[model samples]
Target: MERLNGYKHLILGNHDRGHSLAWWLNVGFDEVSEHPIIYKNFFFLSHEPMYMNKHMPYVNVHGHIHGQKYAGVNYFNVCVEHWDYTPLTFEQIRDAVVPSEEQA
Candidate 1:
């Protein structure tokens, strides 16, 4: 993973348990979370898609939705099955959310 030159953050999945936030941080993650976290005030990161609506201020990037690609208008599914098994960068995520909100 060190081959990649960028920041890395961890959001716990449902199966992740018995570990403290400090444990993850000590393991080398820039940031560690056990629940949804907002990124750059534009992205909602989570293990499972949630809080998706047409009225939110940020888009959701989640995993449990799997190959669905998107769970709703503001959701971007980043499950391994959907992304060819790679992490989505900030640029990739911004590029995915486009059109600046169209009629919906």
Candidate 2:
């Protein structure tokens, strides 16, 4: 994290071993949450592809959908399999904003 000079946030998964938000914060994340974390009107970051009301005004950027990415407009899968074992990049997220696209 120091190398990147970036703010890292965490959304704990169902099986995550980390128990305290403060612990994760001390470990380097700028923020941590057990539920989806909303950013601007464009991002909803989460561990699982949370079941939100369709009326939600933001998009979900999530993991836990291990094999296949969801084929929907309101959610973006950051799961490794969706990205060929690599982390999703900012460019990838921008590309994925298109309703019919996913790869980056």
Best by lDDT: 1
For candidate 1, the 10 contiguous residues with the lowest summed lDDT are: 95-104
- Give the clashing residue pairs of candidate 1, or none: none
Can you give the lDDT of residue 83 in candidate 1? 74
lDDT of 2: 0.74
Q: How accurate is candidate 1 locally (lDDT)?
A: 0.77
Candidate 2 residues 5-81, lDDT tens each? 55677788877654778777777888787777777666878887766677877678888888787767778888888
Task: Score residue 26 of candidate 2 by CA lDDT.
Answer: 77
Pull out the clashing pairs in model 2. none
lDDT at 48, model 2:
77
Give each model a TM-score. 0.78, 0.71
How do the residues 1-104 of candidate 1 rate in per-residue lDDT, one tens digit apiece?
46655777889987766788888777777887887898888998888878776878888888887546654668888888877877778778777676646423
- Which ranges of candidate 2 are over 4 A from the true structure? 1-5, 52-55, 99-104
User: How many Å off is the CA of 2 in candidate 1?
Assistant: 3.8
